[model samples]
Target: MVWKIYMHMTSMLCLGVAAFFFGGLSLVSMSTGKCSLIEWELSSLNSLTVVFVLIFDWISMLFLSFVLLISSSVLYYSGSYMKGDKNFNRFMYLVLLFVFSMGMVILSPNLISILLGWDGLGLVSYALVIFYQNEKSANAGMLTVLSNRVGDVAILLSIGLMMSLGSWNFIFYLQDMVDEKWLLVKFLVMVSAMTKSAQIPFSAWLPAAMAAPTPVSALVHSSTLVTAGVYLMIRFSSALEGSKIQSMLLIISCLTMFMAGLGANFEYDLKKIIALSTLSQLGVMLSILSLGYPDLSFMHLLSHALFKALLFMCAGVVIHSVKGYQDIRYMGCLVEFMPLTVAYMTLSNLSLCGFPFLAGFYSKDTILEVAFMSMINFMSLILYIMATGLTVMYTMRLIFYSLSGNCNLTTLSNIADEDKIMSDSMSLLGLGAVFMGSVLSWLLFPECYMICMSMFMKNMVLMISFLGALIGYMLNMLSVSSKLSSLLYYKEVVMFGSMWFMPFLSTKNISEAYLVWGATNEVLNDKGWFEHLGSQGLYYTFSKIFMILSSLQMNSIKVFMKTFVVMLVVILLFFS
Candidate 1:
């Protein structure tokens, strides 16, 4: 308990530090309207040199502030959520370390030093994901770490490729190296970002990482861990412009958004739904980054973090009150049990769908509008619009099943919002979800982006939301629409309904195969072939050589005496 309070206080102090930076950056943006970076040369003793830089630009400050804010709230929430765990102190330590890593990723302009923080995050997050000590958590932790390891390795390769420049500080060299000659380096960096951000094939791990505690999901998944990739791409935007990889990333990111949104619709697990919601939002951020609007991407990144964190906290509350049944199908009319939580959930989901005047409304709406205005190919345009619509589809599905439907819960005796620790943390995040977007838009953009497009393009998000609401409503009346499930294409539904077979790929295909290979090598090589060929072979060969040497040594005394006597007799005869 002392540790919990200490962590809460520490996190609050972090929030204060972030608040100070936020104010200073906003004031500086107003005055100078330029980036001010403080770079201290860390190593100049050798041929290799690197700078430790903390960029105090609006983007850095704003993003860092949001990360810290979410960190603070998550630590506070963990005090309640993890109070019963035996290793709660270790949990607090890991969470603080995770936050510190996120801070490193946020403040560093040099990719070399940023890799330190990046790798730290992956290691600590793996520990956190597997903290539950269950088989599911174990698999999830392995997937989470392995997926992120790809990025870590990619960064290392990028650093190696960057050695020609004599420094790994990308901010200093990337602008000059934007030509075709540095394409491999740029591609490595982009691939690293994709792995970190959970794009496409690398995306299977994000939802699986929900095996972590809710606080980890709220802090890491919704904001810090997943956003690191997008944040990196945002900084590397100058070098990445007009690259062929950007086009590929655009397609991959759109697929992630569409697939995650569709998976959320088919999902019944409450935490996983929110987890998939986060994946979709990540795709949105990645999409905008690929479109080369880091400002808007950063904007949506901040706002999405605010509400998505709140959404997870709300899910945590519901799960806690209802005694750990995560399936939304088993949950209904939670509003009757916890009104405050339901309200938070509603606002966050609406914000997720880009509902008017909320945090998600500003950045998400602008992203869609910008995409529509761009001369993208037909498939890209359709996917963008449908992904936006699917946001509403999943949000409504979650709302209808979990919040407003019948009170399907069997045991309702213990359900209540009595935990002040959780309530306090969630209430703060809910406030941010409600107001952060407008404030960020006004501060960051100052001037809104004006685009001329058709009404279909402008209203596409809303139209989809409207239609999704009707479908979601009808579906919630389960008896009336039971046949709709049958009417759906079973094979297609099962394919996407299983999250594009991601669970199978991550848990069964990929991870299980590695486990099998590891076991095979251990049995065949370590205990079998290598034992005989390496350790046992050497033992037997050396033993035989020693035995022969010992026999010769024992005989040497007799043989030498006989030889000496014979030589003496022969010498006497010769002398005579």
Candidate 2:
């Protein structure tokens, strides 16, 4: 009990600190006439509009507030959940580091600052994921780090390119770059974003990330790291506009959404299901953002962070109560066993599925509406239809399989209600899932639709999407398998087969040597005899040239060092 009080106080103090920093940022941003709290002066404005720094700064603050809220709640829950565990101190320290790094990621002014925070968050996440130090957890952490590093390379390259061609200052370069240069930069940025957001081919890591504890998964997936990509998209939307890359983004996002939705349906693991669903939802937001609805994307990201965090926490409660078992197949009749948890989970999932008056309804509908408005061709329309259908399919599956399915009373009978701290955390996040939209709509956009048709269209789409979800629920009740089953089955086969083949097929072997030899022979055959010999001679010449250049460079370095030493001796003698 004393430990619980101490943890609660510590979390509260962290929140207080975050609030102070955010408030200071707000004040500075308001004073600076910058659109975001962190300001850089630019000579040219191009198509980008300049607003008071309060706008972007407020967005950063909002994200920071979410970090504080969810991290604090997790810390509070951990007080009881991790009680007397040997690694409890280590866990708390990593958790605090995770929160701090995420806060920095959000509040960071320039790309350098953001990268610093981003890498810090990734490191902390890796540490937390492997906190248990089991083989599976360590492997998962390693894979997560490896995959994120691929994305980091692209980001680093983009930063270098931006610094070389544009200004090293983010806002200045962003505003000054012409469309062509901006397009190139945006392409690199998109690659980084897609990898970080867990879109399409890069998405496999997020489900693997579920090997972490539930609170860590919640923090990584919803509130902080995963959302970084969407934040980047919104932040750089102006540069992305009118680029061909937007079409590619739309296509990739639609495909990722559909694939993730299909994967979620086949997932029996509760956390994996939610993790895949989070990926799908993020894909939808990315698609919407690509369609030129930054505001809607921001709103959806915020709503998802709230509800998904709540759902994950509630899922944590269920897992904790059941002694760490997470398979939905083994979990049933939970409504009666843990009523508060069920209630919170139900509310959050409902919100996730876009039930009326819930947070998800407002954001999801906006995405669908934006898709409809922006889709200009038959191909795009088909993609949008597929994406929407997939969303309904997976969201309904998550709701039905986890919460509304037939009960397994025997297994559930052994479980008990969660402790008070855990319950409090769930209740707080769940209430936000239930009511954040209405409150934020008033506070952030009172005139809302009247001020922006785009915003209005987004909200209308969200409403219709909610109605679509209800229809999907009814369709699910009718006991008909959605036509997507075959596709999902095929995907499963491909995924399993690919995993089996990757480690073996990619290994260098006689077959690879034969293939390489055959390809080389074919190229040689295509060339005339003289040409082939000439090519070999050219390669030899280049090898010799490289050796000569390397030797010259080494000689120069040696000469320079000797000269420097001599000069240093003479200077020392003169001083003496």
Off by over 4 Å in 2: 1-5, 16-56, 409-413, 450-576
Clashing pairs in 2: 34-52, 34-53, 35-52, 35-53, 36-53, 365-461, 365-462, 366-458, 366-462
Question: lDDT of all the models against the reference?
Answer: 0.84, 0.71
Q: Once model 1 is optimally superposed onto the true structure by TM-score, how far is the C-alpha of residue 508 displaced, in angstroms?
A: 3.1
Question: Clashes in model 1: which pairs?
Answer: none
Q: Please state the error at residue 104 of candidate 2 in Å.
A: 2.2
Question: Model 1, range 54-151, lDDT digits (tens) per residue?
Answer: 77776777677778778888887888888888888898889889988988898888878899899998999999999999999998898889899999
Best by TM-score: 1
What's model 1's TM-score? 0.88
Give the Cα-based TM-score of candidate 2 against the true structure.
0.76
lDDT tens readout by residue for model 2, 1-576: 576568656875677577567656645664564654544453445534322222256677766776677777777777777786777777777888878777766765466566777788678878877887789888778767766777777778877776654344455555555368567678877887887797766776677778787777877888787888888777777777778888889888877776776666556688987887798789888888888878788888888898998888888878777667787756665776678788888888778767779998777755565566654566766666665665666666656655666564444346666377788767778878988877666545545553334665555545545655776567555533446454557756566423322323323353478679888877767465546567876888899999977765886878778778999999999999
Q: How much is 166 displaced in model 2, in angstroms? A: 7.0
TM agreement with the true structure for every prediction: 0.88, 0.76
RMSD of each: 5.1, 10.7
